[model samples]
Target: MDMDTFWNDFQLVRTGNPLVLNVTNHVVTNNTANALLAAGASPIMTFSSREVEDLMKISGALVINIGTLNTQDIGLMHAAWSSANAMRVPVVFDPVGAGASTLRTSSSQELLSLYRPDIIRGNASEIMTLAGEAGQAKGVDSSLGADAAVAAARALAQMHSCTTVVSGEVDIVTDGNHVYRVNGGHALMPRVTGLGCTATAICGAFLAVNRNRNEAAVDAMALMAIAGGMAGAMAQGPGSLQMHFYDMLYSLKKSDAERLFSVTRD
Candidate 1:
């Protein structure tokens, strides 16, 4: 997509302010909420199984992050996915640290088999692990590059019939057949916590307005990279970058997006 299309999608988030329901991990809840708000999207984090049904009815999209999963949260995630499917709302799944442990791997696989998410975002190792390939994962950090996981990501996307994203120095977004690589984020982005989780939330925000899952995934990654790059230029370190990141996202203009946007299709 071009800068014009990207700006149009960005404008939709501001004008519509679509409500996004996130059943995300505790660690990134605040960061994800703040990122969504900065991008002009309403965020509601609810894990109550009873309330999720009603919340899905009013929400435009749902985000499921397994960063800090438990038996109860797993059941709640299943319920939320069911509600989202029934309501025909888009769902973004972030299988954080998928290859880190047996539980994480199994939980991600189980969710993928149970419900077809509209989008799945993770690091190279996470996506590769989900694809049933051996991957190197040091906790949540990916030891492999995004380029190395392209084939695995494509396979996973085809198997699940959804958009798959592998985030790294160059973020790779694919929907089985088509692929897009977005580049621009700063090196310091990984130093901060919950940025990947925040990216998944941003994907939900973009999917709320865009019907094409591939475009929505591309748009979200592009926005993240652009904002991160801009913020990194002024910040002294990760701490300051985190603060500036929010400010850049809030004040991000069409011109900024037009100037900073970079993507290549495969």
Candidate 2:
């Protein structure tokens, strides 16, 4: 897609102000909500199964993140997924730390098997683990680069019939047949703890505005990479990058993307 078309998608999220419901983990709740807000989308963070049934009806999209998983969270995740599938609301699934623990991996796989989300976003290790390939995660961090899991991502996308986004130095967006490689994000991005979860939330915002799941995924990752790269240039470390990232998203312009957008399709 051209810069103009991509910028249009970015503006759509800003103008439409779609409501995104996130049933995310405790670790990144505030970070995810703020990221969504910065991207010009309304965010409602909740894990209550009772209210999610009603919330799904009004939300433009749903995000499920398993960063801090438990038995109660598992039930809530299933409830939210069921509600989203029933309401036909687009769902973005983030399998955070999928390769780190048995519960994380099993819960994520179970949800994917039962309900097909609109998109799946995670690191290479998490994606590979979910795809039933060999990969390891250091807690919630990936042990492999994003490029290492392209094939596994494609397989997972085909099996689940959803777009898959692998976040790393080069973010990979794929749907079995087509692939988009988004490069140019700052090297310091991985230094942040909840940045990956923030990326997933931003993707949820894009999915709320754009119906083309593949393009939406690309737009989300490209926006993150461009904004992060810009922010990193002025940041001294991860602490400052986090602060500048929000500012960048709020004031993002077409020229910024024109200069920093480095995406290739395959």
Give the top-scoring candidate (TM-score). 1
Candidate 2 structure lDDT: 0.90
TM-score per candidate, in order?
0.99, 0.98
Per-model lDDT: 0.94, 0.90
- Candidate 1 residue-wise lDDT, 164-266, digit = tens: 9999999999999988999899999999999999999999999999978999999999999999999999999999999999999899987888889999998
Instruction: Report the number of the highest-lDDT candidate.
Output: 1
Error of 1 at 130 (Å): 0.6
After superposition, candidate 2 runs with Cα above 4 Å error: none
**Model 2 worst lDDT window (10 residues):** 1-10
Residue pairs with backbone atoms closer than 3 Å in model 2 (clashes): none
Q: Which residue pairs in candidate 1 have backbone atoms (N, alpha carbon, C) closer than 3 angstroms, thus clashing? A: none
Q: How much does candidate 1 score in TM-score?
A: 0.99
The TM-score obtained by model 2 is 0.98
